[model samples]
Target: MPANTAPIKWAQRSDSLYVTISLPDVKSESITLTDDKLVFTGTSGANEYACDFEFFKGCDAEKSTYKVLPRSVQMFIVKAEEEEEEFWPRLLKDKAKEKNQVKIDWDKYVDEDEEEEAGGFDTSGLEGGQGMGGMPGMGGMGGPGGPGGGMGGMPPGMDMEALMAQMGGMGGMPGMGGEGGMGGMEEMMAKMKGDLENKGGDEGEDSDDDDLPDLEES
Candidate 1:
């Protein structure tokens, strides 16, 4: 008897496709890839499953990769031609083949413009080895391979734009005048000194007034 066709989910970016096979604890598995096709077979317990996908266009099989997770097999497929990257309207070359076995992976999906905006931000300049002079660990908190690394030390699912805006606001604080760093301390100290001098002058004026003889029935 022929093996059953395994169910699959998929999402895509401009240059890559993310595919997930919903077969768990596979005892054996086989995967084959070419410029325009993918073939998969696996066994779990007594059940055998298989699937074949004819891609909408050429793919770079050499650069693609896959991983076997506890509950799924995840695959990342790259487009053959990076210079002409674009999202395929559908995953399969034959539209009719996109039937019950395949579905959209909405959880991993991002539209073209959204992906562009997220990827366009250049973060190289933000990697200051010493974050906020007095704050240790802050520099390495969100660094690559560090804690909360992928999200830039931010809580998971936090909006990047919102975080950046918050940081910008911090730069305006009394002791955070320059790029929200330690330089603000100097500005705050100077302002405090001027305030103290003004208060001293006022006190001196009051003292002189007190020294004047009281007006006698003027």
Candidate 2:
């Protein structure tokens, strides 16, 4: 009997491709990689699992790496072209081949712009940049706050303006005020209070003016 074909999940960046085979506790693993093809065979207890892929573009097989985890085998294959900076439209040379067995790895997917931003923070010896590190979500969560110009770890969907209105004041959060201090919050709260008090005083003055209206015509 033939070995069972393993399921694969893949995602990619401009320079590399990620391939994961879902085979638990694989032993006697054999991986054959070339510029265009990858063949893998392994045994999990009595069951044999295998998979093969003909890549859409040339790859650097010698520089590629793989590790067998408790539940799967993960491969990181580097692209061959020195100037490659675009994602391949399809993973395989034959577009429809093994379509049912392969699927996108959405959790690992990063858009081109996000990848570039992540690349900018890469250190000399860091493996695959900070974005691709073990804590992948850290790159998307921007400096001291949420991603894409949010305030102080605020929930993405919360409307700050509405929230302040409900609370009956407009107060500046820390760091949102001038150069990071409690000063902004203090000023904002004071301004709100002063406005309310002044409005009441103006109403009282208007009532006094109404009582003295007899000299208005003179």
Q: TM per model?
A: 0.53, 0.52
Q: What is the lDDT of residue 124 in candidate 2?
A: 23
lDDT of predicted model 1: 0.70
**Model 2 lDDT, full chain set:** 0.68
Question: 23, model 1: CA deviation in Å?
Answer: 0.9
The whole-model lDDT of each prediction reads 0.70, 0.68
Question: What tens digits encode model 1's per-residue C-alpha lDDT throughout 1-218?
Answer: 99999888988888778788888987688877777898989987699999997998888766565656668877766677866778899888878778767899887777887997655222233332222212212233455433355554666566877765665565644445665453465567889999999999988778656778988995
Off by over 4 Å in 2: 119-218
Question: Model 1: residues >4 Å from true position, as ranges?
Answer: 118-218
Clashes per candidate, residues 3 or more apart or on different chains: 1, 0
lDDT of 2 by residue, 26-99 (tens): 89988877889989899987999888879888887656656677788777777787754688887888767747
